[model samples]
Target: MTESQPHLLFSFGTLLDRQVQTALFGRTVATTPAALAGYATRPLAITDEAVIATSGQDVHLTLERRLGSTVEGAVLRLTDEELAAADAYEVADYARRQVLLTSGETAWAYLDANPLRSAARIVIVGDSIAYGRCDPQGGWTGHLAAAHIAANETQNRVFNLAVPGSTLADVSAQTPALLPPRHPDTLIVAAGINDSAVPLAAPGDGHDGLAHLTGHLDSLAATARRHNARLVVVGPVWLDETRTGDYEGLRFTTDRALALRTALRAWCADHHIDFLDLWEPLRDQPHLLVDGLHPDAAGHKELHRHLDALG
Candidate 1:
């Protein structure tokens, strides 16, 4: 981006301290009440002497994700420069990701982006979320792929294998052909909305929709294991009220959205996959959906913010 513009930011830790906030940005910023979904705060001791001294405390709240918890915090309308300042104040233990607040607004927040390894060969397989059926500006993965290409660090490379409307069932059957001869070292699978669609109450084939979906997930996991690749799965997001009607023919609903997240969580547990369950964070932020489905340009930034941290 030509100098990333200002964005909304959510802080759950010491950044809440006016002293620490002022020390970093040289002024106290006006903040409003806001909260992060699916996160809980616990005491973590600060090892950095400077941070301890500056904030006048060694114990600060560190965040962990739990399905039913929330992290109450202050929301700052920050300029790009202020965000950079905040980044400098956080220790290596913290990384940034975007979150949809309970306020129906999306904002960047500091989260753990711990990875076993920095990805070198990335293969993305999914429907429009991966394909970016989005705002005129485009999708988050597109920007992520571009950043990796530009950096040329870690010998990073991206293979965009996503096609609009393709689900796990389609991907499972087609993966062998979909992958390039140069296999991926890291696989990112983000698909569900398309699969959740019933397409006119036609959930076909005499099986529970959720159960059948998990079977397809198994095929996806098997393919990734065959490549000896690290797997990451992003879950379905909350849809918009207006967009809900369009899927009437497709048999998709917010309830189906919940089923998809639950199935993905179970599947990830069974297979030891890294899962980014978006349903929790995006559940209350239906306004972020652009076409009642996909994230708009800013929402794409929100999604990419989480995915980019994988690097």
Candidate 2:
């Protein structure tokens, strides 16, 4: 039999119940017994009583992080559209985050980003784009900081440590210093354009040693996990020039950003990390960029919207 192409979902609640499943989805689904490590279940009384039967009980099951504890559940295969429906069904009380299964694979599970309004910080790291090298100046990082603070999240801290002209290697090197002992809620990473300059990479088959690019990114993901931060990788955006600024003996073709973006999507998917495709979002929108390099004020505003939508 051919294997189904479906995203993995770890369900510990009513979404798994046979009756409830049929009521919402109009059919039953195949599910394998699964358990989530580092989590436990809590019963939350629904505000509206009409949801009792559909939710599988008077109180719905919610997940809580508890090291060494495992939440027994089922792993179901779902298509992209079904997953979106599931998301809509799971409204306000829950937020989805990647969960590592006992089988050494990763899947999406609803977990709060900022539970109970406690202190949460987000670290922004990247290149000139993130550093706000635009005509008007104030970048998306500043906009995001304001949004987070305005939401009144407890002890909200948005640290923008992106440096201009930095590559993936540079960000990886400085990341450790910028991280605090408490860890961060999110780590926004935007890079690759500068690294594509070729001369910045090691000696290899003319492609600036592209072999190690993925490895560098993987290492950075590990770093983010170590700090208990959710990794949000932003792919390279479109460039106006035919080629990147010359770096010694090398000048990367501007169109190559699209190829990097395509590879990045797969990379992020495999690593179960959040990725923002800046290239496509700003592809047809030329006015958003200043000199076809940095984002204008309106562009930064749009960037802020995309990151917010990432939630």
| Clashing residue pairs in candidate 1 (N, C-alpha, C atoms within 3 angstroms) | 198-250, 199-250
Worst 10-residue lDDT window, candidate 1: 111-120
Tens digits of per-residue lDDT for model 1, 1-311: 48665678888667878888788888888889998755667676778888788888888776654445577898887777888887776777665655568877767776654422345567888888887777554486787787766766545677878888887888778776666575665678888778777666655756555657877877877676555445678888777655667463665677777888888888776654678766644456767776677777777877767656554
For each candidate in turn, the TM-score is 0.59, 0.64
Candidate 2 Cα deviation (angstroms), residue 209: 5.5
Cα displacement (angstroms), candidate 1, residue 157, comes to 0.8
- Give me the runs in candidate 1 sitting further than 4 Å from their true place: 1-117, 201-208, 309-311
Put down candidate 2 lDDT per residue, 2-100, tens digits, no spaces: 765888888988889877667766778899988876566777666655466466566777875444568898987887777877776674667676766
